[model samples]
Target: MFRISVLARRYSTKPITSYFKLFPQNFPHGGPPQDSFIINPKHLRREYRNLQSENHPDLNGSAILNSEVVSNEASLSEVINKAYTTLKNPYSRIVHFIKVNHPLHLDLSRDEISKDLIKKFQSKSTQSSLAYKEILMNVLEVHERLELATSEQELEELEVENEERIEETEAEIADMIKYEIKDWDELMMTAIRLKYWINIRNGIKEWEPGKPMNLTH
Candidate 1:
């Protein structure tokens, strides 16, 4: 059994800057680095807690001194916390991975809207853009489904069936991410679908029968 360690555990530590010149660069964008995609959450969490023990000024074990020192520790702690949060979740880690490792694959430049998923949002300038338009088309379609789910039976069925879609995308991503190198464009496409599926999941979880939802994922 993988004995999962609790994040809130206390330990002895030091000021991160006191020991090193650079902050933890393992997450943020372009981490695990450009060559790596798969992030072991357990490993990430272990590193995170270690850094948290040192950089986290809020923790008594993380050593606080004068006010100026406290401020610097506070800043380091903020960055570390963000990095840990981003790395812990599968979806966010994928987004950051693409941003860091393969900017060209994402190809934010060649379109009217720019790389805010340019391929998906582009206005039918090419065959692929036309297909990509389904991102929004699907969202609206699902929204209609959600609106029609005015009963618990319908909502239950909706989530139970829709969950498979999310799981499939996740499995695809897991397979691709296994390679340290990959076609980031394909991952991006899959990730975008995963995002919408997640939104639909969230919309369902938050919704109650007869109560309207904005459903804007």
Candidate 2:
């Protein structure tokens, strides 16, 4: 087995930015490719265990003598943990993929469509103009419905519908990447819409009657 500890030791001085590269046996392409959107959970878990076994500080025994080695091992272990976690969850994995490949597309700071962004979209009827406007309208409608839901049944129905939409969008993302679709504006907007849907899902989970809707973004 190619040991992750070696990589950790070699690059210990710097941040381990590429988590996928740390586990070559698992992620041969460095990161999950567009075609393979989600990894098999069991396979990922096995690899995570193997990597941790080789690099975990507590298991390193006498290697604790060298403070530098211990520090590096500890850091490596943390990165490994984060890598496993990020890859395990679907939403996080999608976000990570976008951030790594199309970084400029994802803006975590701004959730809603800004006036400037809307202007940019409205300036001309591009490939994603109609789709983007539809999504924007859908977002507003979903939020409004959520806000006015008087019964759990209404919220549950909304949840089911939104979950279906999320699944469809996820497939769209996979297809976009697999086919090398270059409409980055549309792709970015789709990802941002997913973020909103996820937040809405969370708010639905935390719903309370007669309380202000705890929706963010």
Clashes of each: 2, 0
Cα deviation at 38, candidate 1, in Å, is 7.7
Candidate 1: worst 10 consecutive residues by lDDT? 1-10
Worst 10 residues of 2 by lDDT: 7-16
Error of 1 at 181 (Å): 4.1
lDDT of each: 0.56, 0.63
Best by lDDT: 2
Per-residue CA lDDT of model 2 for 1-217, tens digit only, reads 1133542343223222455555555667666562367567898898789767855643454422332323544675676687788777666676666555643433323433233344555555665578667877887788888888899899899999988887777777777677565665566556666767877787788777766776655
Candidate 1 per-residue lDDT over residues 68-179, each given as its tens digit? 3345546756765765676565566566555444523232222321344444335435766767677778778777888877788888888987788777777787778665
**Structural similarity to truth (TM-score) of each candidate:** 0.56, 0.64
Instruction: Return the top candidate by TM-score.
Output: 2
